[model samples]
Structure formats: C-alpha cells, structure tokens
Target: MLRRIEMRFLRPYLQEELKSVKMKSQIKFQIGKSGVTEGVIQSLNNAFRTRKTVRISLLQSSGRDRTKMKEIANELGDKLAGNFKHTIVGFTIIMKKTGARKPENKR
Candidate 1:
C-alpha cells in the first residue's frame, strides 16, 4: 500500500522531467565572399530548430564592405530569428584570433 502511494506521488514529477527541453548552441562560419549572406541566413533557418546563439566569423577579403556586413548582421537578428533574441559580434577585417597571432618582437 505504501509503495503504491509513493509511485503515484512520483508520477507527476517524472512526467514533467520527461518533457523538459534544452536549447542548442549554434556556430556558423562565413569566409569573406560576395552574395553569401542571404544564403547563409536561409540555411541557418532551415537548420536551427531550437533556440541558439550563433557565432559568425567573417574571414578576410580584398573587397569587404562594412555596409553589407552590417546589413547581414541586422537581417540575421531581425529576420532569421526575429522571434528569438540573438547577439552579433563583428571583427575588423583581417583580424586573427589572439592565440593565433604572432608574438611581438622585443626591440
């Protein structure tokens, strides 16, 4: 009789736990190229089903456009995941990860 009571009390908690949801982290890479922003955003929408924070790295290029870059970031935040919140971190052209940079030469 005691065991039956315990099982009944445990059932609701178990059900709630079974329905718990988790969000995934998304990382996207876009090498500096022309006409890729729209395509990338479309791909992200099709791929990311759960809420995710995307990190986009823009590699260097000869004709990188700041206006276009801002536009792409804005569209990602406004259109792709407009319902959800996101963050955009922009790096300067030709910037490398600090760890990958060469050590400074001492005079």
Candidate 2:
C-alpha cells in the first residue's frame, strides 16, 4: 500500500522529467547544394512531430551568406505547418515549435 502511494506521487514528476529530456534533445538536419527542397521540408515536418526543436546546418555548398540564411529560414517557416520560429546562429538554424495560444479578447 505504501509503495503504491509513493509511485502515485512520483509518476507525474517522472513524466515531466522525461518530457524535458525529450525536448532538450534536438534533431539535426543538413542543407547541401540542393538547398531546402521538398524532401527537406517533409523531413522537418516529420521531425517536428516527435521533437520540439530542430537544428539545421547549412553546408558549404549551400552558401554561408547571412542574408541567404535568413531567406531560407523565412521560406522554411512559411512552408512548415503550425507555429514555428527560427534563430540563426552562425551556419546553424535552430527552429523551435511554439505551443503558445493567442489570447482571445473579451468584450
């Protein structure tokens, strides 16, 4: 009886911890000469289903221009479903799925 009670209390905490670990581990994708093609978009969509964060690495052939990177990020954001925001750090683009809901105005 005591063990059952202890497990009941610990279950929620364990689940929360697991979720945090999962979110902390990000999936990585690379963009090569082909650039952000349909395959890449589809792969990112699939990754988002399991992960909250994704790291995209722009390869040398993809070009390292900051302006180009921003454009690619914007393009990906537009094509991807749901609310996803990206941050560009060097040649890596970190995209995170946001779960925030818009506030409804009351009259």
Candidate 3:
C-alpha cells in the first residue's frame, strides 16, 4: 500500500522532469566566459526577470573544461538560486526562477 502511494506521488514529478529536460535542449542563450563578468550577472538577472528558465551556452571563451563551467555555475548560485537549483550539462548552464520577473524599462 505504501509503495503504491509512493508511485502515484512520484509519477507526475518524473514525467514533468523529463519534459523539462527535453525543452532545455531545444533553446538556450549562449554566454561566454566573458559572461562570468559582473556585467553578465545583471544580464542573467534580467533574463530571469522575464523567463522562469534561462538556458546558457558557455562558449570556448567561457572555459574549455567542465571544472571551470562548474565554477561559473557556482558564481551564479546565490542570486540565481536560493537553494542551489542550477545545473551544468556539458558547457551549458540551466537556471530556473520560481519568483516573478523584474520590471522592464519603459523605453
């Protein structure tokens, strides 16, 4: 009985997660190591202001190794994810925001 209850609760979450993974592969913004700059944080913050998920492609300029990519993900951690919700796959970094986006300029 407990196992059946567990499956019922777990099934939807697993399906949704699979769908998100598929969506993540389709469209993602590209950011370079230069994006690691303070300037890029604002850009990312702005990007999240409008979208729940922001996908970034880390170019060769960002770093050629997975370790550097991990560092970049960590830097985007606090402001981006209060609970460490971001992840890096290959050179791509995916971020998700649950709160409302920031206000856009009128210009």
TM-score of each: 0.42, 0.70, 0.60
Report the number of clashing residue pairs per model. Answer: 0, 0, 1
The order of the candidates by TM-score, greatest first, is: 2, 3, 1
Minimal lDDT window, size 10, model 1: 91-100
Error of 2 at 32 (Å): 0.8
Q: Sorted by lDDT, highest first, which candidate order results? A: 2, 3, 1
Can you give the lDDT of residue 69 in candidate 1? 59
lDDT of 2 by residue, 16-98 (tens): 64345445755789999899899999999999998878888899999888899999999999999888877665577778788
- Each candidate: what lDDT? 0.45, 0.80, 0.63
Better of 1 and 3 by TM-score: 3
- Write model 3 residue lDDT over 1-107, tens digit each, in one string: 53344335545875466347647655466766566666677777776655666777788776667677777777787645333356555456676665556799999
User: Which scores greater on lDDT, model 2 or model 3?
Assistant: 2
Task: Give the worst 10-residue stretch by lDDT in candidate 3.
Answer: 1-10
Q: What is the C-alpha RMSD of each candidate to the true structure, in Å?
A: 19.9, 12.3, 9.2
Best by TM-score: 2
Candidate 1 lDDT for residue 28? 49
